[model samples]
Target chain A: MALDQSFVGRTYPPSRPYEVGREKIREFAEAIGDDNPAYRDAEAAKALGHPDVIAPPTFVFSVSYQEAESVVRDPKLGLDYARVVHRDQQFAYHRPVRAGDVLSVTSTIESIKSLAGNEVLDIRGEVQDAEGQPVVTVHTKLVARAVEAGGTGGAGEAAEGE
Target chain B: MTAQIAYADVEEGTQLPLRTFPVDRARLVRYAGASGDFNPIHWNERFAKEVGLPDVIAHGMFTMAEAARVITDWTGDPGALLEYGVRFTKPVVVPDDGKGAVIEVAAKVAKKLDDQARTVQVDLTVTSAGSKVLGMSRAVVALG
Candidate 1:
């Protein structure tokens, strides 16, 4: 089944505020093997004009994508999670996310399209600070593959085009 | 702190230094934990195979981060990164083998967007196993 076309332009409520922790930023940096001092040392970040340790540019994906769960899990959307694959991701930032800042996200369905038996859904996440100021806008595209004929759409079925 | 690269000195077609990042299973596990994305395909080989993936794969977000290093490392300022985007063209498959897989990232200054903002648009090519993994990868950054 294709995603509900009506869901397009629907905006979900803002998620609970998530505090950006220094340790979490450090852990994320380490996981990606990015030893940029600004990601670790407050002093280093301060030297770069940031108040504290700033997250790597991609760190916001953790928060923004999690917020997209509301859309992905929407029963009305009829998305088959098992057959879904990440298609594209883009982030436009107002500033680098800094440690100790609290952020919230409001996810909105940007578009829903069907192409070649695949459902392409785009969700835009608006991340804001405690002051209600925009921090970053994250755009994500997910493609749900169509189930094969006479097949149960069970596990081990690869999506076409890899 | 690494010295910030001045915007005035950068020219179109300037290539950023290349960097290679190794993606082993252990790193994927840590990334999953930190990102709160417990997608089994990124960690469990059985689940990945069940999903028709070759083996355990690195998270697409993880691959994006690794590729951004070229820009960040060049500017020496994370905050300088203003915009970034990528299309997941292929998976960075990580086998159980100790060597895992390596992502090679090469980037260049494709264009200069704004002189007043000192912003330059960067184009990136990210590859794994000699195959492109991220397509249309680009970044906009503020320079000194």
Candidate 2:
């Protein structure tokens, strides 16, 4: 099913503030097997001029992707959750998110297009701190595979590979 | 933030070290829990196969993080990373056996985007099982 083109340019409300904690950052860093001292040691981070231990570059995706649920899961949008696959991801950081920062995300639908019997979605999230200062801009692309009509339907690959 | 590399010393085409990360089922589970991405394809072999994948696979984000480590490890400062991006070209299929998948990452300075801010673009070649998993992978970082 093709996505609603009108949904393009739609903006969603900001989510409640999510507090950045030292332990969470440490856990995420460890999960990725990154032993960067700045992610665990405040002193190490401070030595690098950060007010506190800074998050790894991809940490905000946990928050931003959650906020994007408002759009991807909208009943009116007719998206098939099971058929969706992540395609592309990008982040533009204004500054590294540090421990003790309270952040919120406002999501927007950047674009929607259909190709090769698949629906592709583009979502951009603006991540900000408590004072509304930009922390990072998260852009994600999701692809919904085309169902085969008794034809050999390959597992969704093309869109993801693109 | 202070970077380990001095901007005055680096030029375009500077090569960063190559890194190889081991990806096991346990690591995938830990990543799913920490990142709040509990996609079954990452941890469930049956589910992954049922979904058309060869076997259990690692999350695209997980591969991306492994690739970014090359830059952060070089700069010695996470704050030096100004931008990062990647295209999910292929999935890193992780088998259930004790020896899981291995992701190899190599990076280099592809462009000198700025002088005053001391920012440069680093391009990464991320491969798993000799197949490119992340395409057009790159990061823009500021140097000391």
Top-TM-score candidate index: 2
Clashes of 1: 1
Candidate 1's residue-wise lDDT over B57-106, tens digit each?
Answer: 88888999999998998999888889999999888889998899999999
Tens-place lDDT digits, model 2, residues A33-83: 999999999999999999899999999999999988767898888898767
Docking class of 1: medium
Off by over 4 Å in 2: A156-162
Per-candidate local distance difference test: 0.87, 0.89
State the displacement of the C-alpha of residue A84, model 1, in Å, after optimal TM-score superposition: 1.5
In model 1, what lDDT does residue B119 have?
Answer: 89
**Clash pairs detected, candidate 1:** A156-B50
Off by over 4 Å in 1: A150-162, B1-3
Candidate 1 lDDT over residue span A1-162, tens digit each: 667788999999999899999999999999889999999999999998888999999999888877897789888777987777788899999988999989999999999999888888999999999999999999999888777776444343342222
Error of 1 at B70 (Å): 0.8
